[model samples]
Target: MDNAVRNRAWRMRRKPAGLVQQDDLELVTEAVRALAPGEVLLRLVHVSLDPGQQVYMQSTQELPGGTIWPGDVIRAWGVGEVVESRSDRFPVGSHARDHHGVAGVQEYAILPEAALILVDPEAAPLNAHLNILGMPGLTAHAGLSQIGCLQPGETVVVSGASGAVGAAAGQIARIRGCRVVGLAGGPEKCAHLTGELGFDAALDYRSGRLAADLTLACPDGIDVYFDNTGGEILDICLGQMARKGRIVFCGAIAAYGSGDSRGLTNYLRILTHQVRFEAFAYYDYEPHFASALAELAGWMQAGLLKHREDVAVGLENFVPVFHHLFTSGISGKLVLQVRDGVTR
Candidate 1:
């Protein structure tokens, strides 16, 4: 094991403003110390740039004692290969994915064996581990099956439907025989959701007539609502929900970096309609991960599932590429390819 290896990482420079700026993250280089027992040195290949990163930076939420601060290594989900191993769990040259949140936005990461989930590159493309076969896929399965308790012939509505989690959730619901409707930002994404992803309907939320479009698409009323962008769209869905509907609150990208809350005036409908509103984290359902992964893998192999990735090449381009996540209308999962030729 080489203790002289240099690691380049991106740390939070400061809390973001209205939108994430380049100054919010600073790249730093440090020498990697030798691994301890049960530790493995990982060479990061693909780092997931998720909307949750923005929430972690601004929110006061903390692990146990302290909140995330400037100079702290920005936590992320990534795929890496074990370069040096002191544990049998992760032998050298084996690829693994972060379990909960140990991996960060760095070229090299030293993680304990317990935090690493062994991945098979031969099963699917390496980047798929960061998208459909990763946390987003688990989030979708848990939210739809467990939280939403989705049933066949039910009308399901998913906001931010073209996004990673949202897209997966919609497809999962569709596979379960639900009539899935998606709400995306533009016509292009809406088209992709309906045309490619097999959603029953795709509505452009940016269109002023969200209520009208939703009514037209979901004539049966929404039995389940998978919310990723919680704001006006959520309120609209809440008002149009069927009696005893279920809402799985997965993400609130609409409120991220805005520093302002869009109060849900229609929350009273939860009581009137007897709706069940539940918020879930993917890690909370870890016990069911193996089943979910097997199902998702089978669907992919049988051509029942499809996934897209918007990859941004180069580690140095992390800042601008991260900013592109919010501003640019890039669809699918956003991943940072820190190193190339290793996966392909």
Candidate 2:
């Protein structure tokens, strides 16, 4: 352990413009420092690429400086193994999922023991902790149970339905006896939603027939709308809400990179339909994590829940792979494989 290890990390090169570009991030290598008390050095195995990270980069409300500047290590969620540890909480050889600020696009990281969520490699594959059994899965549970107030036999439409959170939400709603319909970008993802995920129907938003397709799919009108993309798609769904319907504002990926902040035009429908709208964040339901995890795991093991991962290899490819999330058509969860030997 006397030799210093070279740690490679991706840092913001400049503030991103419209969509995240390849040059927006640069890979930098540095020698690892000695771990202090209560510190653990991790070898990152998998990293999650979420649309919310784009909003984090552009948001000025949360950061002290009002901007994520150059040379800053981009924040993300990563699953890694503790190669070295000085704390009993995160002993050496333990697998863990790191918290937001401590985890990033890096090959290795030195994080405090308190920031790690100890994971059992035997429970499920390591990558599953980043997908259906992780943040996105918890997000789906919180939105539906706490906010959406979903009822059996209701018609539910999930925007970005092929993405991680949306996919989980759709399947969970189906398990709750709701008629689940998903709206994805392409036909392939739409097909996967209906054929593989047991959704009642799937709509391709890119088909230019969203309104007609939605009407045909939900003849009774949508009782619950799990909105992942908030833009024109939201407007379309808003106009189709049933009386006393509920809307879960999970994300606004449509407006993340773009500077457009236009208000919803069809918002008056909420008042007319007596609709209830609630915004959800997974952290709010931390107390219920164990129950949610158990239920999702049981469903997964019973073959009732299914998920997919679009994995990109190597830390050097992090920037472009992240950019692919917004532009390229990807189904299910988007993950980056920083190191080898991690299971699916």
Candidate 3:
């Protein structure tokens, strides 16, 4: 372990106004400081790019204020290989990641022992830990089973269905015997939802026929609506919810870019339909993570659940790739390869 080793990370340069621009962040290089007795030196392999993390770069109504300040490293969830370790929990050459702490957008990280979670590279692709086997999959499971109270034979609708959490939620609903319908932005994503991920039906929200298309897909009304995009799509789902239905509020990607938080006029349907509208935060269900991961892994191994990742190589591509989330530039879980030539 050498303190002379250099680390590269993306640091916030300015508070982004609407969408995060390239100029808002700066690529910084510094010497990797020596690890303490209970710390680990990680060569970050893949960094998970999520829509919610973008809000930390700027303020939004949901978050109220920005959590990250200028000059701070952009935080994300990521998997890394322990190249040097002063802790027994994380040995040299072991793979680990953190969903609970700041796994920044960097090529190398010096993290505390408690902040790391060990992952098996042989169990699944290393990147899988950042997606289906990680937060996105766990979020989907907890939302559907614990929050949504999803039942077999019920009709479940997922908005932003091609994205990470949405994709997992739709498949998990299907695995649990629900008739799953997905809504996405384009025809290609819609097709991938139904044809690849096994969603029962898919509708393009960009077609300007969302209401009619959704109505046709869920003739009996949606029993559980996994809402990832919380704008007009949410309002449409609100009006079409079945009696005693549930709405799992996982994300608000629709408002993230535009900053136009269109209020749901059909919110009154919550009372009329006796619906349960609840927001999901994965930390609330942390106690169940091990079991959830095991189940998701089994599903993946058994060919029941499938996950996709849009991996962009090099740390330099982080800014443009991160912007892709809102523009639908990539499909599935977005990941940035911070280090090159590390075989998966």
Candidate 4:
């Protein structure tokens, strides 16, 4: 409705040498104008800042060095509402869950239907689309259900247990009647994972002797491991896996920095134990998106599922929030609240 609109978004100010810090980004307001023909203008309500998105910000060997350009609006999957539209198919006031990482970031934006999935916010919480009903949700379902072959009454372990994807994976495994063990950083998060999220067991990696503790806690051995943290913990899983176990490497938050990517020397156990190690990307499971969302929604509606969120107010908090993730101090999905009325 307005010729010019303002948005607050994080922009890269400098290349991060090691761990990225707040000094690397700037939060500035931008103007938003009406769209071209067939374009729809959107106002971001809830933007999901995931661990993979954090890796995108860094210069990495996995991606081969193309980093987020300075001043480019950060890319992410988010939920927004169309306030103005030139496209008839997506009329004004329609809400959508966008697909592309970044095209525009604003209180108002003009976007294409190809980059967004339209939905009614009344159907679920806006943040749900960024969590249990969005990319992370799909990754958890596809990895556990399809790749991990999670069986009922089986023992399962989830590293990075409190993260967006890991949180969803823990609950889904429990719902499948599997005995779930969540490995996090501190006792508080461990308690939350076990008591609040309904996981059967929660282990703190920060405690002395993580590997030994993991061995003691999982005496039955891990039949399935949804690993988000690699490095030492991954090696421990390899050493302690039950015969014919399955492991899913979703993300490696531990190896994100420190400039070294070491391999697990204990991988020979995989051959002896006949364990299967499979790594997958959510992008590869595109078709399963709807099924995963439907199941997650049903669980939520039935009160058999719950999700928590640590919301950072304003886009300015985006850069600092990444530290909370790596430090393992933060709990639940890390969401950037660009504006109010996120749940409403």
Candidate 5:
């Protein structure tokens, strides 16, 4: 290790308005200080990009660990290699991930063992630790199994089905023998969902015929709705829900960028049908993470689950790649590769 290693990071400069503008965050470089006892210095390979990042950029967003503010390192999760370690749990050269802190989105991160999740480099690609075998997959499992009470042969509808969490949710539902329907933005993403990911049907939300199309795709009505995008799509799903249906509210991408979530007018459907509506934060299911990870990893290794990543190289690409989340019709998990050739 070099005596003087420079660390590059993106810091939130101000609370963003509507879409996150380039000026909202500033890139800064400083020397990495020596690690303290029980700490590990990580060379971050890939930073996970999520829609929740948009909410974190706002000053008003309430967070358990507090919100990201001006001059604070933008919060993210990532997988990396321990380059230098002062902890027994994280030896040098071991792979680890920081899913509990704002230490990501930088070329290097110094974190304590308690904040790191030791990962198996041989189980899957290093970036997979940030995707399928990590938060997204875990979120999908928790939402469907714990909250949705998903049963075999049921009808499942996943909005934002091309996204990391939704894609996993749809596939997991399918693995349980459900009739899975996906809603994405474009034709290609829809095709990828049904053709590649084994969804029964996929619809483009941008199309003018969502209501009719959804009815056609799910004639029996949705038994479990894995909602990632809130707003009109949510309202449409609410209207078509079966009696005693379960809704797993995982994200609100439709409203995160603009901070203007549309209120549902069809909420009476909840009362009339005696349906259950539940929203969850990822960490709320931490106690069950180990079992969830094991099951998801097994499915992935057996080819029952598939994952995709739209990765951009360099920490400098962080801002633009994040911007693409709302503007560009990019599919799959979005990631920023801070260090090259660390996929192992």
Candidate 6:
């Protein structure tokens, strides 16, 4: 790794509305010099494009030197390998996770020890660390442990059953010995959830008449409802909660694009059902993230957990894979494969 190699990346050309579009991007290729000291050059393996990026594109200027400008490289967390390193903490052949907003998409990028989390192959797949064993798992764990206060034998219902974070929550609920029911968009996804993911029952939200379907699924009443989708779905879940039931709000994918939050007329259900609703934000539980990862790795190794990643090749495909998050159709984790680097 002697001669300097230039890298191409997708730079946000302008702020995006609803979803970040490719047209808002521009590619810039520049030769990066060889590392001097305490620096590691990484070849990005995978890039994560999450639905929350809409917020990043909107208000990046609020942070100190963190503004999302046209010339700035797109920032994201991804697993990469150190091809050349001047620091022992990040040695050659080492794999690390970088927090710098934009790094992947380029064939090569430079990273520092502080920006990485060195990983072992035995722990989990590189992508898994960025996915199920990473933020998605944390989201599920924090929501369940905190907001849901999930109890054994309680009937817990989760929306977006087949997507990455939602699917993870369902599995965790099952492990807790709770009767798990999922609400997803399609029949195929519903079938996969109940048949393979150990969900006791799954309702296809795409079929309409969700209220009736939910009744058939949760005959004992919903004890813990994890509402990932807002709007009418939340309205329905609110009306169906058992007395003293808990509600955890993990995400509002249902309201992201339209920019219109829901107004529920079912406020009376809270008093009648004695329901407790808690909004969940994963960043609030970052201190316990280590414990969450430790448990996730053990579960994965013991074959008690499973994960799926939807990969998009090249930097150009990050937008499309990301759009799947808002779509009611796509399931599993969405990731961008910048280059071949590592697996479990």
> Between 2 and 5, whose TM-score is larger?
5
**Tens-digit lDDT string for candidate 6 (1-344):** 45466777877888876567888877777777778677788777887776556556656466432546666677766777778888889878877776444455566777767666687755667788667877788889899997888899999999977888888999999998999999988788889898778899999887879999889888878999998887888889888999999989877777776676869878798999899988866767877877888888787777767898877677666677667777754567877888543432
How do the residues 100-194 of candidate 3 rate in per-residue lDDT, one tens digit apiece? 74788998888898878899898889999989999899999999989999889999999989999999999999999999999988889988998
lDDT of each: 0.87, 0.85, 0.89, 0.79, 0.87, 0.78
| Location of the lowest summed lDDT over 10 successive residues in candidate 4 | 58-67
Q: How many residue pairs clash in each candidate?
A: 0, 0, 0, 2, 0, 5
Clashing pairs in 3: none
Q: Residue 309 CA error for candidate 4 (Å)?
A: 0.7
Per-residue lDDT of candidate 4, residues 82-146 (tens digit): 88788888887888877555533345556787767787778777777788778777888898998
Name the top lDDT candidate: 3
Q: What would the per-residue lDDT of candidate 2 be over residues 1-344, giving only the tens digit for each residue? A: 33278988988887777676777778898888889999889888998888877766666557431245678778778898889899898888889987443478898888888778888888787878889988899999999999999899999999989889999999999999999999998888888999999999999998998999999998889999999999899989999999999999998888888776678888999999999988877777888888998899999999999989988888888767887778745766999999665643
Per-model TM-score on C-alpha atoms: 0.96, 0.93, 0.95, 0.90, 0.96, 0.88
Candidate 6's C-alpha runs over 4 A off are 1-3, 33-39, 59-70, 99-112, 340-344
Badly placed stretches (over 4 Å) of model 3 are: 60-66
Error of 1 at 232 (Å): 0.6
lDDT of the structure predicted as candidate 1: 0.87
Candidate 3 at residue 120, lDDT? Answer: 89
User: Model 5: per-residue lDDT, tens digit, 225-318?
Assistant: 9999989999999999999999999888888877677799999999999889999988888899889998998999899999998887878878
lDDT of 2: 0.85
Runs of candidate 5 with Cα error greater than 4 angstroms are 1-3, 340-344
